[model samples]
Target chain A: MDKENRHHLWLTVPALLSIGLLFSAYGLFGWTSFYRATPGGLGVGGDFTFDNYLRIFGSWRELAVIGETLWISFALTMISLVIAVPMALVIARSPSRLVRSILLFTLAVTFLSGGVTRAYAWMVLLGNKGLINLALVHLGVIERPIRLVFNWLGVSISLVHFLLPFTVFTLVGAVKNLPLSVEEAARNLGATRMTTFFRVTLPLLSSGLVVAASLTYSLALSSFLFPLLLGGGRVRMVANHIYERLFVAYDIPFAAATSAVFLVLSFVVILGFAGLERLVRKVVVR
Target chain B: MNRRSLERPYGRLVPLTATLACLFLLLPVVFVVAFSFNDGAYFQWPPRGPTLRWYVNFFESERFMTATEHSLKVALIVTPACLVVGLPTAVAIARGRFAGRDLIATLLLSPLIVPGVVTGVALLALFTAVHGDLGLGRLLIGMFVFGLPFAVRTMVADLLGLDPRLEEAARNLGATRLRTFFLVTLPQLKSSMLAGAVFVFVEAIDNFSISVFLTDERSAVLPVVAYQYIRDFDDPTVAAMATLLIALSCALVFAIERLIGFERMMHINRK
Candidate 1:
């Protein structure tokens, strides 16, 4: 063999090993979803069956959980877009490095502070006598502490926070790609700034918006902690359901089945958005 | 009249909204830091007094310390493992003109797309099915699996972003492909590699959904232990530990920004 060929062969080993191990790991995970769980509730024992798949999909409870998960994910994505698009616009349009860095720093802290810590922080903020409640009471906004925890409201708040930085990062790329001159020309043509933003800039930003929403949606859909901790066991995200099936219910086959379905569903949703993004690019970005 | 109406609303509104949004985004971390030093035992609003009691308790407690050590050990080991296994894949993708490249890239990065909870449950099932006990080895491998995508993504970005002419120039001067890669390409990847390593390390420490299933009583990482502690005790010790982690992460982010520039770090997160 030639020297270059040998080097290519050798260099390819680690990459190949990584690909093999990853595929096998996921493959095994996918493979085991087919078998029936052991009666002992320890592991899979019986022959392959579609019963596990049937159970997860057939039950209304499981179906609602899936629906709720998708709803929360969509809500999280939209909220993140509302909050992040403006900030990302500011970041992209600002000529000052200081402003960009400060914004970026806030995003980094939010993005990197880990979900558990973020959840705890939200707990402090949203607890019955938590800061927000206390402040609201002091301000006479409410007569009593509201039930923020153990509900959809709490889940949405935390997930929005968790997903914000990602949305911002995605949007920043999109906004940066937009030419400043386009907005200027629009304004010079007698369009109002807001109109220019809504008509020209936003249409141009459709691709980035889709990318950000898709990312945030997927993250929220698969979210475990916000629902587990902040949702206070009352909220039922698919992730929490999957966790219960595996650890609480000791139903391995059901858990695996749920996971396989979850994987497929997430791919479908993400790819759907990617397709939407392509469509938007074709129609609007031109 | 037109300029005043046009400029005043947004000029005032944009920064105000942005500031408020940033504050809302940052409030949670600020609260974690503030409450960690609270004199009271439980996590409650309005501190009794500023005190380091929780920090002392966190450091002095053997269980918490051990969990912290476990977290550090896992991150330390997993970062290097990711680099070794992921770099070649990144190099191959960047340099090779092979078919199915995009497919291969997607497969390598699949872990990032899959939910952590699902990955955790799936891996736990696989481990138990193949081997009875979920050991530290299995946990390490699992984490390495999770970290591989980030490492490869970062390295691939770094490699692709660089001018190819430098490596090509070295090769034309008679340096072997291996030597050129090691001397020319590897050195250039140092900053991004450091950033990637830090990212993976933090990920290993921060990972809970996957680790929770894989971790036994004797092998819990800090986040899992903190979670259990929160479940059992309402003390500020977990808050204290969290504050410490936040500090460490901030420091790492600062270092990464210094090493590779902050914009580049943010760009690496795109994948």
Candidate 2:
């Protein structure tokens, strides 16, 4: 028993150490949020207070930043889902091998490139002299280049691209799990295809949809580059705000406070989705 | 004979939507590739000519080359470190069947769920709280945290698929536990290890958000440098660099796809 325990401990030590380091880091971060900023702007030094937290909530600007972050995150998740479900279904059920391989290759390229390159690609496409603008000019569709980059529109487009592959693959897994015979039986029994899809297929994908949504939401909320680069410093999300507070403003306490609120907000969103998924599971299973 | 429910446009709609979505995903990538050859400095349509100047410029620039070197160095180091740490934990998760196993798994995977910005800031704060400056060491730790969960998750999935009987049979024939794992089990895990290594390497190289916070003057990675360059200049050199990245990523994906197939390699959540 002793030897076995020792072996188990040895196997787990690296993972334990990594997680331990994270907990300690975040714990100190959470603790630092409570410390009042010293009068001099050098560092935090005062006794415990809720001033940092209050300041984050009390300011109208800060409140709007949080709201915008949540809104963008939610919008990206929903838009990606709307776009991905059909794509996933086709990928899973397509009869043509070429179509399947092409779709899979597209997804693999996007996923492997990760978010930074994807964002950069959007910049190239959406810039003033970019393809869209240039095409619009030659066709006389518009007299001037539309402001696509450095705004919510640019951020949303890039974010949706960044998010689509994950959702599609996830839904592919869910769609593959579904027994095709059930759908076939429903169609054979006089149910319209739309009705069969709505009553049967969509509900069965609830868990996958939930997981995808949560993933998309958190990524969007945590987005720094999108808003920083695409937002043109005009759009500020929670992550960007925290970064500014820490580095630009040099307000460590305020940044810590913002981080804390952001963490809580993410937890709330996740738990809310989990609850929604439970409700969905109950309705779908019955 | 009329087809059943020919009224429904299911065939047309599904393919149309899938094509559009794939186009949306690839449009930017195609843009990057094409624009790199544009003769103009800024993005322009109906190019005056096609030239390799920007690609040449990207290779010629000292700063860009240095950033690429740093990124390559960091990714090369982090990949093996992640696998070294993650592989054993993956085995334990797959085979232990012990108390707190689920909790351990959750904790290990928590970095995936946590916001990268939060993790970045938390690490920043932790380092500052200890009076340490942000540099290569902190950056590696932050990235290691980000990549470890992915490595472990992939390995765990691969490990769970193995039949225990193979190892058991080996053990029964007088092979020691360590010897069984090395001679029998490790070979089976090669594909997963490769997948996880590639993922970690790509992620570490492509990392911008967490590394953004940790970057000092001496430690700017390619993505960070590219971001700063784009912020200041709208040149096609960044486009050329981005094209290089797209090429590298495609090569990696193609290599892995040929090795183990794309879907199996990347479907980390596959049951």
| Model 2, C-alpha of A122: deviation from truth (Å) | 1.7
State which candidate has the highest DockQ. 2
For model 2, name the residue pairs that clash: A150-A230
lDDT of 2 by residue, A181-278 (tens): 77777777887767877887787888778877877787777888877877888878888888888777888888888888888888899889889888
- Extract clashing residue pairs from model 1: none
Q: How close is candidate 2 to the true structure, as a TM-score?
A: 0.93
Q: What's each prediction's TM-score? A: 0.94, 0.93
Question: What are the per-residue Cα lDDT tens digits for candidate 1 across A16-79?
Answer: 6756865676778777778877766556767877888898879988888888788778877888
Q: What ranges in model 2 sit over 4 Å off?
A: A1-6, A38-42, A137-143, B1-10, B172-174, B266-268
DockQ of each: 0.52, 0.58
Cα deviation of A192 in candidate 1 (Å)? 0.6
Model 1 docking category? medium
